[model samples]
Target: MKCPNCQSENADTAKFCKKCGTALSKKSINHEEMINSMGNTKSGDNTTKIIIIALAIIAVVLAGAFAYMFMSGDSGANDSTSNTAPAAKNTTKVNDNQEKTASSEKTAQPTKTSMSILGGSFSTGSADADKTYAQIYVGKENAGTDVIVQIYYSRDGNSLNNGNMVPATVHNDGYLYITSADAYLYYPDHATINLYDSSSNLMDTQSVSLSPRSGTQTF
Candidate 1:
């Protein structure tokens, strides 16, 4: 026999341990109790394992659901982008081609006039409410019996066509005048004045030139 309280060896008929005063029991009964306790412990272990497996399965299911939601949203965005990409590319190509074509256009030429200058001048003077005083001269005399002055500066893009001509004073072999104007006229110096016959035919068919002189205002 063995003492149950102290796990000590003892005589089979002993009611208590001789050395430690502990109770004794049969070996068969102890063995049976140990087997039963081992069975109960194994059952408890199985229950704990089942609980842990259930929690793991739930975690896996939640993770899979979240992954599905993320993938679906990403798929929708990709579909929208794919649909718009082709149109955006086409528009870019069209704009680039238009820019290249516009850049290749030809440049234009400018028109020129056949204007001749008889003489030009800048002098001191002023104008009234409707007219301005101008100075004009010619380097050579007209060959024809009579000559008329046609002061043709431009006004508003057309010939001054005031249709008025100032007659040369015909003095000292040089033509001089303090004329008037209602047209495009400026006198910084060297302005182009045209010489014409009474019928407005251009004179000085051979050649024409200008000379410089100082100016003064004559009331």
Candidate 2:
């Protein structure tokens, strides 16, 4: 037997320790119960450590997953922006090319040539009764010095003076005049004027009718 309050030897049949005067019992001296309690406590501590380790691992895994997702999202956004940038650039380039093509076509067109007779008149020489003259106000565009003007006279739709062409002389006031020296006419009632360019191409024509007058007249 052993004392419960203090470590001491006693007789197997003794109820109390002689050295310490402590009563001993079989239940108090049982070593197996103490060993079992120590084992249970150690097991509980191990279980707690395992739970904490598992929780830490789970937290680390979650953080890693979140970081990967964030990085992937950023990469996707960058890729989208890169792709859109090229498309926008290509669109702008195509628009510029189209505008340039239209501009070039417009620039390639040729200018038109124009010539016209603005006004005209008919006259007779006072000194010579058989001689008549014609005068016209000429307006022209892109014309040169080689441009020519001529006139033919008639009476009552009947050709006179054999439909002779009377060449005209240009004046500083933008008027062309046919002198008696060019053609001789006697009381002409109608006239035809023709204009030609340097290339001998007929540019314009005009007709005039003369009212009965004593001398010079405008038509």
> Each prediction's Cα lDDT score?
0.54, 0.70
Residue 205 error, candidate 2, Å: 3.4
Top TM-score model: 2
Weakest lDDT window of 10 consecutive positions for candidate 2: 139-148
Evaluated at residue 205, the lDDT of candidate 1 is: 27
> Which pairs of residues clash in candidate 2, taking residues 3 or more apart in a chain or in different chains?
none
Over 4 Å off, model 1 = 1-25, 30-39, 62-80, 83-219
| Model 2: per-residue Cα lDDT over 49-138, one tens digit each | 999999999999999999999999999999999999999999999999999999999889574344677887777755325577666777
Per-residue alpha-carbon lDDT of model 1 for 1-219, expressed as tens digits?
A: 656666676777887788799666554345545878999899999999999999999999999999999999999999999999999999999999998877765443332222223444444334212333444444344222345555443333444335466665433434445455442343222233555555666764222122222344221
Q: Give the clash count for each candidate.
A: 0, 0
